[model samples]
Target: MEKQIAIIGGGIVGATAAYYLSTLPGGQQVKVTLFDDGLGQATTAAAGIISPWLSKRRNQQWYQLAKAGADLYPQLIHDAQLGTDVYQQTGTIVTREIPTDLELLFDLAQERRQTAVTMGSVTTLTAAEVQAKIPLLANAQPGVFISGGARVDGAALVAGLLAQATAKNLTIRRERVHLTAQGQVVTSLGARQFDRVIVAAGAWAKELLAPLGITADVRPQKGQLIELAVKDYPIQENMPVLMPEGERDFVPFGHGKLIVGATHEDDGKFNLQVDPTVTADLFASAQRLMPSLTTANITGTRVGTRAYTSDFAPFFGPVPDHEAILVASGLGSSGLTTGPQVGRLLAGSALYGGTPDWSEYEKPLATYLKPSAE
Candidate 1:
């Protein structure tokens, strides 16, 4: 009998898991089904920035997972055959307003580089030098550049991975679904049993787990951003991603296209509405660092919901009492950075029976997922 596996989400984690599980050796022994409603998924709305070595966060576990995820991109790109338009190693430039602060970040990058060889050459650049590298940057602040930093198109990545998996006979249902404690997936059509279920539903994991009497630590955070098109700036195509001191980071793509803004609204819960005032403010804030954006035409806007935990840490593993179900959430803005690796680990667990302990990469599953008091 074929092992039945159902993945309740089609975002980065779920899609990547589908790709791995369906394409792995002896995959014919297992059947994979992915459910995706195409709603406010965070991956499609994200500006995929892959630099994690310079993070100031003190979470050592998160740093480990993020570094590992960054390291997996080469394998992912190679296996998935992603085009240059889908993934690029143009590198990253991190700017700081205070010269001393920039110096501190540079020192930190150097200290971290000993362990993170993938960070490539870490160097400090004068404001003029930074401007030369990224012509749109107008800020006078000094910056640090990391050669290994890369950017990806999140939506493109998921599509490519899913396409690969689908070619391998992975079943995809375009419907919202829920799970039962008995290891069944309930779609609008009906309920079906599965040997295993993986929940990578982003913020909606809370609702999906509710029916199973589990309390998920996930909460919804609304993120909004805008894409801009600049005229006569072909060089903007391969310009390195510019992350200034604040929320407005710039991710450049080919054909003079750039992504900016991405306000992290912690209280905005699941709302996907694009507030013109908020977008206007984002453009204003972006103009502070790259005044050239003021003349660039706004091509489009994207609003998506991100999952976050109170402690702002990500967790993934089997449900406490319901080991048949696996869950991953609380990725927040770093989902693009850590998602693929998490998916790979989850797929490995499903393909080979018995969970591979990942306690070092995250807290215990019980910490974020627990039995409901009711």
Candidate 2:
């Protein structure tokens, strides 16, 4: 009999898993189904920043995971062979508002260089240089520029993966899936038994796994972004993604438009509505970063609930006692960067009952996550 596999959530992880499952060896015999709720999806609302090294996380496991995630972008973009309407290695700039922050990033660049990690060339730019490149910064603080950083459109990437997966014989279903205590999977369309089920439900993963006695240690973090058009004040064509310290970051979305994201608030609210306060703060930050933004048109706003893990690493692998019930969630603010890697590993583990070669960080990560602690 053929293996039955069900993937809950059609976000990046779920979509990538389906695409890889359709291509991995021994994956041909497995019948795969993907479920998507089509509501409040984090993937769609994400600013899709792929610059993980800019984060302050110092955990080795996390560093490796994030590095691998960033490394996969070029290949993915090429594999999809789609136009560069969404994914591109535009690189990132980590601006420093103070001298202390600049010193810290310089040290980090040295360490990253010694390890020969592919973080692109790390260049220290003077305050004026930053403003020259962006022309938006009123006070161009000195910062470290990472050449390997890339930008992605979360929604577009997911759509591409799903489209290719469909061509490879994967089934796509728009349904809210339910799992019974008896281990059966059901949906409004019908009920069925799957030999394996992978949940990549993003913010909603906790709700589905709680009843199964599995603690994913995941929480919903609401982030809001305001879109603006740069028609009045033109930016450099090869402009890099900018994180000019503090609470704001600017991402260019091509053709005189940019996305400034993400207020990280862990309130348990799921409304996904634009907050007046959030809008005001981000807009103010944008204008400060580049006074030119004052002339840009406000292209509405977006809100998403990203899944954040207690240990800052995504939840992956089997759900404790339930071998058939696997999970990949809590990718945090950098989900777009790590989503593809999570999919590849989850797919491999499901097919072969062994630790993946790139999963050396898994053991220590599992210990910290404490999915099922004593």
lDDT, residue 229, candidate 1 = 76
Per-residue error (Å), model 2, residue 157: 1.0
Number of backbone collisions per candidate: 0, 1
Lowest summed lDDT across 10 adjacent residues in model 2 is found at 365-374
After the best TM-score superposition of candidate 2, give how far the Cα of residue 256 lies from its true spot, in angstroms: 0.7
- Relative to the true structure, how large is the alpha-carbon lDDT of every model? 0.87, 0.77
Candidate 1, lDDT over the whole model: 0.87
What's the true lDDT of residue 6 in model 1? 93
lDDT of 2: 0.77
Could you give candidate 2's per-residue lDDT for residues 40-109 as a string of tens digits?
Answer: 7888887667877756676777677777888777877788675566787777888887888798997887
User: After best superposition, candidate 2 residue 236: deviation in angstroms?
Assistant: 4.5
Residue lDDT tens for model 1, 1-374: 88999999999899989999987776778989999999999998877789999998898999999999998998899988989788888889999878889889999999999999888999998889888888876674679999999988889999999999998859999999887667689889889988889999999999888878899988999999988876546676678888887658888888877788688998789889998888897788777776666634788899999999888999998887777888899999999989999999999888886868787789887788878893
Position 306, candidate 2: lDDT: 85
